[model samples]
Target: MKKFKVSLLQLDVKFGDPEANYSNVEKYIEEAVQDKPDVLVLPEMWNTGYDLERLETIADKDGQRTKTLLTRLAKHFAVNIVGGSVATKEDGKFYNTSYIFDRKGQLISQYQKVHLFGLMSEDDFISAGSTLNQFIIDGIKAAGVICYDIRFPEWERKLMSTGQQILFVSAQWPTKRIEQWKMLLCARAIENQSFVVAVNRVGNAPKDSFNGHSLVIDPLGKILEEGATDVEGIFTCEFDLDDLKAVRGNIPVFDDRRTDLYF
Candidate 1:
């Protein structure tokens, strides 16, 4: 079986502080690279942690800065990157956006969060993405989505419909709803019969607390790696494409779907 190693960097993000957060992320990435994982993952809002009010001034200008840095890192290390979501500024509007890069440092896909957490006033500060995200890395079909987007099974279904075998989620989920975060991730993996690699931030914002439970789950809804709360750590896992195929074949949920009669 062919296996790929993935590293998830679960770190605490300083609220409203991009410089400090960037330095922190850089340090973690350096540490994660020592293991020579095929892909490096980061948590959500790593650039400017939930500082909605200051996003206009603090957000990455069209994500150029993040792309440049990630691209350079990917090329230098010769590894793929699931660059976490950032507060992105474009056309005078802000958005929660994610970027992915290939081992050769090629930009593959970028996803802007579609579902804005109205409870957090995300609707007020960010522009929602209008398209479904699907991309390829090393000939593997993959999809990228933001935090709140995970609640909508239809979105994950759409990605699965496109033959996505791996789902990458980046979130700044609150500690109060940590259980939902974990359950939903497992559900997505089980329902879609795909690998789920989710990275959530740790630490507290002005009004909310985040408990990092970043996890990598296999197709059978088994956790391969999980992170601890209030700490910085690298959780690594090796996934086999053959194993995913075997699990899906055993269950065959996708083949058993009755889509036309449902909706």
Candidate 2:
């Protein structure tokens, strides 16, 4: 299908509490399935919100549990899931990771957050990822990234240049800079000529308060749907791959790039 619907979970995470978060996740996922969107997106660190010190204690072990839950949900609901970023532990180290499950519940993509936000002390607790994640869902090419990656346009362009039509970002952005979150997502969509689907969490953690400003933006920079700050719910939007082609064809941003001049 050239056009499809997506539902975002503007969910809330309990700091250092995976059990509570899991229940919340289940409730939201069940509710989101009611909309029967082709894809479901969620926030970064939804499993444990910025509970850095508790990484070793609370992180998902090798992401097995995360995969199991997402897989079952995707299969049962018949929906693709940009499963969002979660704290995961592997080989005695922790990483912020994002997982994607196809409609069949097959794990399609796994992206560990490459950029660790120094301001949040992420650099101290989590190991950085060195790879990019790009995959196809129902024949549509897409990419997934964590919260801080939005500030780096080159990363988004890297995927868009390689035929990615949709960009999914999952975040646990604090309340202080929610405006920047909205602006950046719109800018990414407009600049890349692709649909940007960003899901953010709401409520508070130990050190920060999250504002749920999850959004879906079209290639022309239009805010298709947005969630309210500090509210928990599902926000859904629909878009067509044809729109990406139209935007790219009209501006030719990629075709007109001066690759030879960049430092």
Candidate 3:
């Protein structure tokens, strides 16, 4: 199989301000499209940055606006999009949500954050997602998860069992624990034997600071591309499906797992 080029938009979202953040991210997306990547990714909370107090007022109503904007961009550029997580209002509650669009502008999959961050009081403001996020892009099985979701290995294992080769993570990780973020991401890629693409926001929030270490890791746990801590930029990397296949075949770790005895 031929390799696919991917771009990660590491943006600096203005705290508690949706309009400014949205406009800034729109410009980043416009610039990213110039690279003509197969898939373009954004960081978490691209719509509203940690404005949980005002979610009831600011959350996207049923994620309609986000879908419309991302779908239009996907169609216009003829590229797949893994839009970062947004504060989405459905029914009477709100959730941290992600939307995926195909090249033809079709909404393929939508995932709400399953693991809410209690330290930030996310559970108080948002409803947790009930289902796993799995989709196929360009005939390749892929999965996506939110910021804190990476802490759970079982979730990624579940997706791997379903034949996912590309794992996309959108995060708003804090600068205080950047080492954990990097270690966890590399571990996930190494253990799952799949390509791991993570996009994290930069700049400071109201109560916390975020260091943008957005990166793309190969199946062998090699860092292909990474972004700087202080700047807003787009990083691109090419991933070869054949290389992933060879790595998995040579190791056979998944095939040798003793799942039947684990329970």
Error of 2 at 84 (Å): 0.6
List model 3 lDDT by residue over 173-238, tens digit each. Answer: 999999999999999999999999999999987789998999899888889998888778999988
lDDT of 2 by residue, 52-169 (tens): 9988889999998889999999999989999998899999999999999999999988999998999899999999998998999989988888999999999888878878889999
Model 2: how large is the Cα RMSD against the reference?
1.2
TM-score, each model? Answer: 0.97, 0.97, 0.97
Q: Which residue runs does candidate 1 get wrong by more than 4 Å?
A: none
Please report, as a residue range, the 10-residue window in candidate 1 with the lowest summed lDDT. 254-263
Q: By TM-score, highest first, what's the ranking? A: 3, 2, 1
Q: Model 1, 80-125: lDDT tens per residue?
A: 9999889999888898999999998899888889999998899988
TM-score of 3: 0.97
How do the candidates rank by lDDT, highest first?
Answer: 3, 2, 1
lDDT of each: 0.89, 0.90, 0.90
In model 3, what lDDT does residue 133 have? Answer: 90
Could you tell me the lDDT of residue 51 within candidate 1? 87
